[model samples]
Target: MRGDTSPADGDKLGREAPIPRQLQQVQDDDLDPDSVKRHEEDDDDDDDADEGRDEEVAGLVPRLSDEEERSARRARNEGGAKLGRATTTYREGDDDYDDEDHLNHVEDGGGSRSPFADRREQRARRRKPAGVLATIWAIAREALPTLAISVLSLVFSGELLIHLARWPVFVKVDKLFILVPILLNLKGNLEGNLSLRMSTSANIGELDIRRTRETLIFGNLALLQVQALIVSLFAGILASVLGVIGGLGGASEGPKTAQRRGFGALLTKRRVIHHHPAPSDPSMRLRNSYFEFVLVIATGMLAASMSSAILGSFMCALVVVTRQLGGNPDNIASPLAGSLGDLLTLTILGLLGSFLVRFEGTILATLILLALAAACACCFFLAYRNAYVRELLSSGWIPLVVAMFISSGAGLVLDAFVQRYEGFALLVPVATGLPGACSAIFVSRISTALHSGKGVSSSLSHSSSSTLISALRDILKLGPTEGWIVPATLFTIGAGIEVLFLVLVWVTGQMSFGWPFAITFVITSGLIVAASLYISHLITLFLWSRDYDPDIYCLPYVTSLIDVIGQILLVVAFATATVLGDQITAAVNDHQKP
Candidate 1:
């Protein structure tokens, strides 16, 4: 009835078998509900002839005229566009999609509907913090053995003083009490820088120990040795000047005079004692001044050279081992360098001073000075040739020298106080070494963080209160463990070392302040270490905020500050220990009387 052709065309199409009524019914049922309803209404309007025509058209794959075919293709394309729009809407309203629909969509090769949501989920999983106990255990496992070795090394540093006690030069030169600590602090500063440079270089793959001469490692090593020589020369001259002025005040008395005059007289005597016994001798004073100068200078040179050689070598090995173990050398190298520098510098100074004092005016003394000068000259020439060495010298050396001078002043304070408190003298190395080591370690860690481009953000350059808060927050984030755990661990280690140091003193028959004094010393040393670490952290953050390199600016000042603070705290601890011990003794006496 709706055919374009006549009855012949209809009959020709009808020659093909028609679809069964059941299949036709299934096909009609599969149509959209609106389409099926419209078709049923259309059937009611057409009656039987039209109904038969609709059944035939539905049963067969209806042929389309050219215009109809074009329209059909356009409709199909429109339906495809609508399907794409529906998929986008479904993804945006992901909660509206059933889990089965989501599964079918994925199974059909559609990617994750919400990629951003998936990424957020992944980030949430990644950002979880480790448990507190686990973090503590990890840091302890990492730090304890190294810290133990550091403490042992610091304790051994007392051997330097013990050996110096055997040296005539130590007694002959009045300024050595001031000079020794200065030189030890200087050596620590230089070597600590070397360790930092090496650790940083190694971290970034710049350090190649096997080919050190061609690498930055060689330049840093050269810089360290040259700086050591230069600083040694400066320290020697400064100490010599102090010695001369000290001689003017009758302070350069020999050990024999000190022993004979009693501790009070020895400390109060302001004139240089001439080797000559007679008091009416002007020549005696001039000769004694020259003796003090030569003694201080020679001892300074020897100490510096020995420390550079031994500590430099030790630092190289330390860097290599730390790198091989995949541990951060910054955390351990500074303390190791500091403790070893103290032990070796003091011990070497004593040994060389003992020998040098024996030949003070002899040709051997002249030969030693000439040799030291020659060695220093050779090292300087080599350092001058290196570009990195030159840069380090220009940028870094002056601050270090200034810091050493300040440390020398701290040493002077210790020397002045040593005569008043006998136990104080014995505790000086422990007081100075432990806190210095702790601060040095922290400085190294902060320096490494700054270098590695972590922790400190560049936005902190504003120096505003908000920026300061941000900078502090960055520091906390950098080493959250450092704030509490590190300080506590350092305090525990320091207390143990203090106990060991006092025991060593008592065992060696050096000085016996007894158990109450020991308890005071332990508590004080722990407090000093905690305070020093906190100060170090503050200094590091301040320097880092200002875009200053903490490695060069921080270690020297911190170590020097620790020396001053350690000495004051030591004195306080001694006073507290004495009062507490006296009270305990009085209580015991009163109880016994009852």
Candidate 2:
């Protein structure tokens, strides 16, 4: 060896300790190519660490050499942003999700309280109800219209009206008889209009407070009104001709005298009889969809017109007043102006109501109602299945239905109690109908919120199943927070709205009380509720069929169906009541005479 230790000798001295058995084995093995690659990766990590250290040194303050300050500032900003987002989400339920969109607030406040505890008991109570006799109920409802119509027609026959006019009550209130037809038509037409608009909205997300949308809704009803006017005029003429014919002794009643009397002369003498189509179409085949809609609207208007004007007025007022309450404030008007369009619609519906009720009789009117209901249901189903409509309807209906079922008997009972002592049932419409309308509005808001990607991105991820499980656990422990709170609020608001409307209707009823009116209103309300439930369920099924995919369309079909049915039921219900009242009156009179 040279004077300095040779390289081999130094290496031997420095590498005196042999590598451990595990390390030796790793180094020796060629089985795992990754072991050798990992060793190479360690060297790259060392190089990166050196570069990172240089960057840190360069960024250091000249004198203070402080890095912590910049880090702290970043932390504070992020924390502040997160807190603001959380706060904003809890309060303003609108679509304001972006961190930058938030209003800056102070430091984190106190812990929040749960908003959904009120429904815990309710949820527990909703475990699948026992099987109801739905078919029996449905059949009973089906037969009700014919029974009611025949009875009502018989009561309003020229002979009965004459007999009734002899009574003191009838002598003073004879003018009120015209109201029966007016109201019957109003209820059917308005409900049909509502269903059409809602269905269109649900189908395309296009049904807004916009002038165009409102016009579409209003225009259709206006046409129906025109149809009603023509129908009534025709009916009046026919009745007059018949009256003149019957007035003459057999063949002596000829065309010349009928013409001289004019249609008006005979109309005043004979009881007017109107004929309406049945619920199930005679053809029962799918024809031109649009044509059917037009027919249904016309029929519904015609049918509802047969009810008393007082009832029609109540129905129209409820619709006109509450329509805005059912709309989504966020919806962009579809080239149509806003509330003005709704006003125009109300005006149209009102005009149609006036005409329909003026001449149509109860028996003929009920058919129009059933036809409308069927038409609406079909439309709703179509729209719900349509990809576009499902998106629109989804935003509102789910919450509305839930709220209705929850508060049903409870709110109605309360309303009954309120009206019992002082005969204040007239307030029922305001109390019940208003809240129901409001609920519709709020539920709409909630659906729009979810669509907005505000609180949480609405899209379910690929791993959503796992995430859902995690979320459920979190919910069980912590209660409903941001996302869930939206639904809860919507549900409550809907319930409140419905309750208000019921109260309003009740209050309005107290102002006038004829046995016919009473019987008709009760029957009409029950029918209305039943039809609403049926249509609502159909809509729900349509919506869920899309697998809760908000992107799908389904609401329009259900809403249309409900709207049509609701209108039809309103007319039928009123007609039934009228018939029941007449029969009772006749029975009482016969008993007194005996």
lDDT string for model 1 (1-594, tens) is: 231335566478564333332335448678567666654553343344344334333432122332332233333333321111112211122332224544333222232123433443455457666666765565566555666677677657765565565565665555665577567766778888787777665553334223332345555666776788777777777766765665576575545445644754554453445343335533334344555466567678777877787778778777766666656676677778777777778777777777776665555655666787788777777666654455566666666777876776666777676655655655676677777776776677666545544443333344434566676665555542234665565566656666776666567666655677767777887888887887788777777666666666777778777888888888787777777762212221223242
**Candidate 2 wrong stretches, greater than 4 Å:** 1-387, 390-419, 456-546, 549-594
Error of 1 at 433 (Å): 1.8
Task: Score candidate 1 by lDDT.
Answer: 0.60
Native-to-model Cα distance after best TM-score fit, residue 486 in candidate 1, in Å: 4.2
**Model 1: lDDT of residue 463:** 47
TM-score for candidate 2 = 0.27
- Output the lDDT of residue 416, model 2: 37
lDDT of 2 by residue, 1-594 (tens): 112335566488564332332345456776467875654454344444345434434432111111232222233233321111122111122122222212111111111111221133245356454233442343233223322332223223323433433443222222223222232222323333243334323322223223223334443343333333433333333333433345454342323333544764555455335333334532223222332223334432443333212232333333333333442231211111111222233334334434543333333444655665565455455444333223343343343333323333333343334322222223332222322232222223333333322222222221234454554343234311133333333333333333344344345442333566555545455444444433333333223223343212223233334334444444453445545653212222233242
Error of 2 at 544 (Å): 8.5
Candidate 1 wrongly placed segments (more than 4 Å): 1-138, 169-178, 208-214, 251-257, 260-299, 362-371, 416-422, 461-488, 495-523, 580-594
lDDT of 2 at 577: 50
Candidate 2: global Cα-lDDT?
Answer: 0.33
